[model samples]
Target: MSSSSLQLPVIQNWSCHNCGGCCREHLIEITEEEKRRIDKQGWTAADGIATERPIIQKIGKGRYRLSHQNDGACVFLDDSGLCRIHAKFGEPAKPLACRVYPYAYHPTGEKSLAVSLRFSCPSVVQNLGSAVTDQRIELQKLGNQIVAGKKRDHSAPLIHRNSVHGPQQVNWPDFHRFLKAFDVAFADTSVDFVVRLMRVLSWLELVEQSQFQTIKGDKLNEFLELVTNASVKAQPDNDLPLHRPGRLAKVMFRLLTAQHARHDTEADVRSGLSMRLNLLSAALKYTTGFGTVPVLHGSQSAATAFEDSANTSPEQHRARFAELEGEFNCRTAGIDELFTRYFRVKIQGIHFCGPANFNTTLVEGFHGLALMYPIVLWLARLRAVRNNRSTVSLVDVQTALATADHNFAYSPALGLKSALQRVSLLAKMKQLTSLIGWYSR
Candidate 1:
């Protein structure tokens, strides 16, 4: 099927500014075909390519990835922050994955595709450059390549699956109905951003418990309205009832946050056992939630990208977890608009659930996504405190979102059974909203 029917996000704008962070931070796995093409390119010492190792390395049995240079960048990355492959050959000659950075395409219907941006890129997080809708032609071509051989018609991802319901499936039209409801709920600007999320969470519990087989078309819309209105009635205004996350919740969250804050670049991998040991120590500190917050190495990409390049003395390296707990005055129109855009993009692209997330049900997936608010705010608070500022700014939030989202759906550790359980447990203990409200203080 042709990828002519592409749905681009209107609220977001992105264009790569050649920060080269993605090239350094990500290990690009190549297909056998791509590896063979690179081998045939006849690279040598004269081309500035490393001669010590083959351009491709075997990661596992028959699994291969591009090699990194001594400075921990893709072998194709040049000194001027450009891809050697693109300069030598063409953009088409590069690996498909290389061409698809910052944009994620997923099947929204049999013939249509939805594009979601990865905020790991500073350009994307800042919403800088041209509007995404204007790039439909290029994105459509990429979408065609992505879904070239894949099935055109795919079954909709399950709505809510569990021991009680076994597995629940809905038609694509009805599935989109639920998505529309989500979009509308999030689009409501009458309430505070966090309150809007809390309202959705309040009703999503009903979605988890209720059967959806009979909820179709107008019936589904009515059901959604009923539940959403009920949620608003429960909590009318932004007078959020804040409660501290329980000790267990805090420990689990800190560990998870620590994972998000890490940088698993090829450089870190090449450091070998010593790097692993340092990570182990940091993990221990996060688990205890005492003393100083460990200086997670990869967490500073945002600071590096957004902050003045000449600021040598960064204090985030010395912040304590307790220091992040103090109020940073997180609520503001600008901040809410940033989150609104972030959440809408995810929802509209259906990027929070199904194959895009960790194969979680709708409720579970949204809960996991909601957890990002606190995590991002907490990291933003850390960034604020590091700079000797008592309040968080949009830049801090942007940096935190970029850093935390690097692992959001891409990290293998986050998809594990234990990680999934942490989200569920937080919701069960009624700590999810608590964390959101408390951290957004």
Candidate 2:
């Protein structure tokens, strides 16, 4: 790929701190060639590494994955959080996936690739080590390997919007403009993050409703401007509707929690179901007005009568806000920085939507992908609340990411209906701003 063709955001410096989080957290899927390479390494118990069950295990009928130790650490991971392979041979012998810690690549166009990072790493969240831009040469080499001899057909249809340009024809710069606007929308401080998110969703809904082919320079700009304006204005009042949790929301929450429940060891697995159940109960209770409501629902009509009569001062509410914000600072920072970068990077590369939104066209796919950011953010926040942590953990972020990515990658069942369902909910809840607040907190 020519340097000019590489349109990804310049990397700031980043080097893995060897937290061994990924090693333990991920079920490493390896290609057949990788398996052979590891076999040729001549690893043994005498290498000072445990090799009781071998390092590799068969996952499905034909697929193979690196196995974890009985303790749930990567079989190649040592007590010092070092990789046995790197220790035994060298870093070059590590799997491509292992070598590409934090960095992820997706085909941007037929001839281009976009880079994304996993912020679940503490180092990544803190922006530690060298700038990402400094790693350009290495990232390019990896990109070459991934895209080499691979023919990417960019003629796929876009996801939610009715754009006629098809995936390959959509100009990347235009996509970047949309993304920049999105970032700005989230950065707006006048409204709550939830309200900001709702505005973006509302705009997306409009885009999806309109025919993309008919949308040109001024029309597009006008629409975006209108959406931003609406988002800023559509703040929820004190009497905002707080309805019961829908069945779909409950099911999605359960599904998401179940995905998070998987672990490499028995102990992790044992607690997984219980944790998921508890989270589900919490979600239903909070969203459905269950906990705040009386068993005799009708008798509680006058229960909140004091809500209008109470004389709590604005100073008191501000103090409470300050307290919650302080409590959630660390959690909010980690999530916000990670996600903000993640969204901008993907948007710049036009990877979030378009072809990456399954094998689809650019416009609709972009809508679907756009919706995912808020959904994942929402789910991660829920996870944080469930774990009693102020911030979303790298593990939870990774799980949410893997879950959403896996669905888009493999599930043919996710169609326009699913895409629009998410868009509607996000727009209604103004979830983008909520995500920002979560990160800010």
Tell me, by lDDT, which candidate is best: 1
| Number of the top TM-score candidate | 1
lDDT tens string, model 2, 1-441? 433145556533468766676676556778788899998987777776666676788878767888767666677888888898898789878888888766767664556677766544455545568877777788888777667666676432343433343223334444545666776776664544444455666666565555545565567677678877775566542123323434554344334322322222322443678756755564454344222211110101011211211112232221111122233333344454555565555555445554554544444454455555544554444444544456656545544454344343224445445544554454345443343333333
**lDDT value for candidate 1?**
0.84
- Tens-place lDDT per residue, model 1, 316-341, is 34677889988899998888988998
Residue pair clashes in candidate 1: none
lDDT of each: 0.84, 0.52
Off by over 4 Å in 1: 1-4, 151-153, 299-303, 308-317
lDDT of 2 at 6: 52
How far out, in Å, is residue 192 in model 2? 5.7
Displacement of residue 107 (Cα, Å) in model 1 is: 1.6
Worst 10 residues of 1 by lDDT: 308-317
TM-score of 2: 0.65
